[model samples]
Target: MTPISKKLSWVAAVGLLASGCAETPKELVDARAAYKRVSTGPAAKTNPVQVADAKRSLDQAEEACFSCWDTSAGRDKAYVALRKAEYADALSRNAMAGKDLEAGDVQLASLQKEYLSGVNARVAAENAAAAAALGTLGKTQAQLDADRAAAAAAQARAQAALDKIRGKLTQDERGTVITLPGALLFPTGKGNLTAGGKRNLDPLMEFLRTDPRKILIEGFTDSTGKAAFNQKLSQDRADTVMNDMIKYGNIPADKISAQGMGSQNPIGDNKTAEGRQLNRRVEIILLKPTN
Candidate 1:
């Protein structure tokens, strides 16, 4: 070939190479770097299949750039490749973290077992020492008997006090509950206590003033109106009762609470007038002492 012709061909080749290099998308570059990092790191050993999938995606990106001459397609495939590499790396990290967590859990369980053993040993020693002291004193049995008698007397007194108050009294898991009909407490669709309502509550309030039991006043409504209106009305009535107990009954504020159980826990069918009357009632719950 002539010298000039050879030189021209070389120049054209250099230009093509420069253009190809310049046109390499940023996504492809980033994907190549990510794949290199993941493939050479721990992910390659722990998640080889994921690494291989990333490699295939990278290959497709390269193919799109060179063969298809589509920069957008190439970028999409490269992004997929980058995400796959990152996912593989994340999986490896998560697996390692899980192993660490499992090891930590095993260590914690061993520590707890050792602590419990020590605690049990100490408790047993204390019990044995107490038993010996009790045997020497000769009063442990007598003290226990006295405590049982006192507890029984106290329970009887409490029951007697509960019986003295006049209302529909019942015992349940929540303690002694006194149900007062809504019609007796307030005018229809109103929160203010009626004159008779105040009188009706006087006995219960007097009992609460003497007894130091915690009180929970729950106001309920029948399904006669919009639920929202009923809920607000019930809440207002409960709050008013709670305020009265605190203000007039001289009950400690901290020992009393109130809530509106809007149209819930119906004791009677809502369809009937009698049932609805029963459903719309306020309950005064005398909570049992926790101590």
Candidate 2:
């Protein structure tokens, strides 16, 4: 070793050592500070995935500025910037999930306001639907009232027509008239039909046949006799009249149905002498077929 060469080598070694000893950061301290800031916040434990994303962003930021770690302050600032980026990443992750950002105490505060507005709009729609239903009900009630009025008018007309004929209906009397006068219909209380009863019913039967209206021969007896006695007598008289009309009057059987009303539906008052006479007669009411 020459003296000059040794001195140069020694100087070079001192320069290198001085450069290494310079006050500069080896690792980013600011990044750790920013990470601490985020970790200490409210969602630190509740949202571990968000915290993890924040840490990853900070690490990435630190990695991006590896060439500029000459001073401790510069390294700290770089790490701080990294933590800022991490916080932004965590916020973005929370936004993708379907949570009210503000109410959820997460990233996006504006989204919570939007959710409340939508809920209010739905309430307003329901109110509108209820109003529409009420309107329909009112219209239906009005139509029903009109229909009721029409039905009342129709019932009134039918009642008026029924009241006019036959004066108030009364109890009946059957064989009383049949056994009186010129040859009793079969001489006595016998069931055999007589020519005379046939003769009387023929004109009416023929008229009914021509008009195509149904005829009914209902017989009745005065209340003076036993109920069983009158029932048989009345039924016999009705049957006799019915057969005569069918055989000689050319009346359709379908258009006639004979019944013994016994002592029912008297045309005149049964208390009066004339009332008994009127009630002994046969009655036929026609019923027209409906189309």
Candidate 3:
């Protein structure tokens, strides 16, 4: 061997031995312990990606130990690897927590949307029901109004027909009244119906038979006669008229009544013939219908 080459080889071997004798830094020991804990512990199964990253860092640190030969540079590498390994584990846990929180938020949003839809559907149903009820009420009210109008029109026709047939009518609190002179129904001082009276009453009797209205026959006499005689005569006259109406008109007996108001509510003075004639009268009162 050449003298220069041999001397260079001997000097390099001595320098390598001196470097090997240097003490390893405490940071390297701690770095190795940290790497072992992460790779072989629970983190290896649960956090495989993080554990792999930690193993790479540990490999780099061990390579630095051989390259730098226990110098501070080697310890620095181990320290960096330990920090990186811890960060990987913590980052993986935080990511799992974030994913769980995101899923929870999505589920809560879906539930809220479903609840709002139910509320809206319920409100719509209630509104529809209320509208249908209101429509029914309106229809009922319209029917009632139509019925009332028809009834009023019928009553007006009845009044017009009665006035045309029975002469002018006067309405009072009691009922509608038709007044007739005593000469039209009976002879002077007589309770019997005259032939002309019977003929005149034929149309009225037919009306009574058709319509079946309630009736009240009232008789009055002039004050010229004795009070007792006039009362009896008036009563007999009213009874005769009622009996004739029931027989000729085929009127129900239960629908008619008779009364005598002799010398009471006189229409005129008893001293004059005209006034006395006016005072002697028979009245027919028509009662209101039940329905």
Candidate 4:
């Protein structure tokens, strides 16, 4: 061979070797990039164990690429390494988010504790101020004891008076209530008081005259009638009872008021006759003294 042709053949061989050495599969390149990204990111700190696993997978892929005879084997290993790196990164981010959530919960708990403490402090301060004001008003411990005794005596007297009255007597937040049956007081669908009703109310009037307590007369009816009719009838009956107490029972008009409850606040099952009878009633509430 000629000298020039020999030199050209040697140069061509060198070029081919360089080209083969420089060429790398796309999967391997992608895997190397993914591993580097995860190792350098928060995954390095938050998920060190997973990041180490990802590094090992990348090393295996590099070994496969350099030593394995088959290109597909190298590619498959590279794909696995890429997936491991991505999983590590995802896990790291999730762990970081969980930590942030934990921190927020701690802060929220602290805020709630602070709020409760503030409320307790305010309430204690208010109580202290009220006690001081009471002291300034010349309310000694002896005076306070006397006031409590007086209040207890008043309650006992009211209870004793209520026990003497007939009808279903109940005590609630509104005061003492006496429920009188509508059947005994009036004929069905009528507003006028029956003879038995007048007799029943006579005791109530005498009690009121003696007790001198403020009163409210409320009328209720069963669900058998139309709502409008029931409402009007209840109002008329309440008014009639109030007028009778003022005229005959000698109760002060200024101390008594009347209202119609209609079919509201049923005392029993409306479907049964006994329940309906129980529902139709008049309620006289003896209000607590303003003192």
Candidate 5:
């Protein structure tokens, strides 16, 4: 055998000989799958916060890789890259759920906690190194203070802009569909879009038209009534929004599509009045990528 081949075979034999009884580690397998999924999965609904979160995780994962310190092997931070990408996809779905989606509780909570922990760990490590480098004039301290101030200002502006966009659905957010508050959209036990609801949606239609993109208007209702009847009512409501888009927004008929998802995906607890309200909603989905 070639010298390198013999060395690799010896290494593999030693690794196996030193191991304890082994089955596949579920965590490792699951994590690897998630990583691959994020790298390859089709674009689904997502939002800015989720997008940012995913990217942060990915960056962290990449940085964690010891192999990344090397220039050859054509390798990236494989594990870290995977985790961050999938985490971002998860975040997108979580934000779309708003206050209603219970399924996102575990993932969203875990992500926030992990992110904070990672940030604290990184800062502590960096601060220790920086402290060791302090010179006689304390110029390093001054520079750090200035950097903090600039970062804080930038963060404030970013947060404000995010808040503005949160109330409205961006194309990324629509990938994770969540029913909006039914109470806000219509009266109790009614399928009709109230005048106030129509007024509120006026700005949304305008937003859609600004980009000349196709929209899918979906209507959903609670499961309190007959399924067949609710389906038709939901369709009718979706039609109402399409009519508004055509008449008021001047969007073309072919550019918009409408459907009803009556009682199929309740975003919140249907047992409570508030939850029921959260369940009934008109979702505006984008058919094509938008700015």
Candidate 6:
């Protein structure tokens, strides 16, 4: 015989010799199946001691199964062993469930602690940032108030200087106005500025540099000329003044506008030489501030 076959035959003979007194019964079969199911389940890994106890009970029940139906003592022994096997399986499963519940409770408590700690840290950071922003805003508001006050004082000084430059000027509901005699500024029927005319405009230039006010220069003519001739002459004179202001006074050209009145809004009648001279004049209007 082969050596491997001889060893397997010896093992089988020993198993039969140990179970010689038992005849497998339905109760023993059921008890063995129940033990196998529990030993393969998660309870075996968590409660191996209880699984071993269930296996022992199943072995005892198989031994009692030989005469379980014919003898009362054997039947009673088989019933007791079956019950013990079932009880061991239930105990093992219950122990595993209790261990899982305890682990879950521990993990939940740790997570709650971590969550509360993170929330507190975030709230502290937010509060600190808000306090810093409020401090910066307070300083900014103070600086803005100081700047506004300085601007008001500077504007007051500029207004006083403007008054001195335009002698005999009037402040009506239309704002400040300055009148210049046409004879002093231009020759008769001409747009050229005389030497004396240039000197007279020096103070007006100085005031413009500081105040930066918007200006409108209007020129007028007497009724002695044709309407078209008068209109062109007045426009040329107004333009001459505006160009001189921009070139010599360093005033921005966009701040000033000029137009010809052509004898409109006359301060005197145009019949006499004196009244006509008065009608032929230039007027300067200064705009007011918004604030």
Q: How many residue pairs collide in each prediction?
A: 0, 10, 0, 0, 8, 1
**Candidate 4 clash figure, as a count:** 0
Candidate 1 residue spans exceeding 4 A from truth: 1-166
Candidate RMSDs in order: 29.9, 13.3, 9.2, 20.8, 43.9, 12.3
Cα distance off (Å), candidate 3, residue 23: 18
TM-score of each: 0.46, 0.35, 0.51, 0.45, 0.39, 0.44
Ranking the candidates on TM-score from highest down gives 3, 1, 4, 6, 5, 2
lDDT of candidate model 1 versus the reference: 0.85
Candidate 4 lDDT over 1-291, as tens digits, reads: 899999999999998775664467788899999999999999999888888988888888787776535667778888998999999999988999999999999999999999999999999999999989878676677788877786566556545544544467778888878888888788899898988778667766766755556899999999987999999889888987898899989998999999998999999899999999999999889887877
Predicted candidate 3 versus true structure: per-residue lDDT over 1-291, tens digit per residue? 799999998999989776674455676677678777777665677688877876787777777776644456677787887886686667666777888999999999999999999999999999999999999999999999987776566446555544544543566767767677787779989999999777656656755555545899889999986998899889888998899989987889999999988889897788999999888888778776765
Q: Give lDDT tens digits, candidate 6, residues 1-291.
A: 799999999988987765654555666667667777777877677667767776776666555555434544555555666666667677777877888889999998999999989999999899889888888898898889877775576446545544554434656655667777787678899997888777667667766655556888889998987999999889988998888888998888889889998878887888888899888888777777557
- The per-model lDDT (C-alpha) reads 0.85, 0.58, 0.77, 0.84, 0.62, 0.75
10 residues in a row with least lDDT, candidate 5 = 66-75
* lDDT, residue 219, model 4: 95
By lDDT: ranked, best first: 1, 4, 3, 6, 5, 2
Candidate 5 structure quality by residue, lDDT tens digits, 1-291 = 999999999999877754522332343344456655654543234444544454555444444432333322212343444555666667655555664566578788999999999999999999887777666338767888877876465445433433443333333545523234555566765666688766655655545565444678888887778998889878888887788888888888888888977787786677998777667777776554556
Clashing pairs in 3: none
> What pairs collide in candidate 4?
none
TM-score of candidate 5 relative to the true fold: 0.39
> What is candidate 5's local distance difference test score?
0.62
How far in Å is the alpha carbon of 40 misplaced in model 6?
64
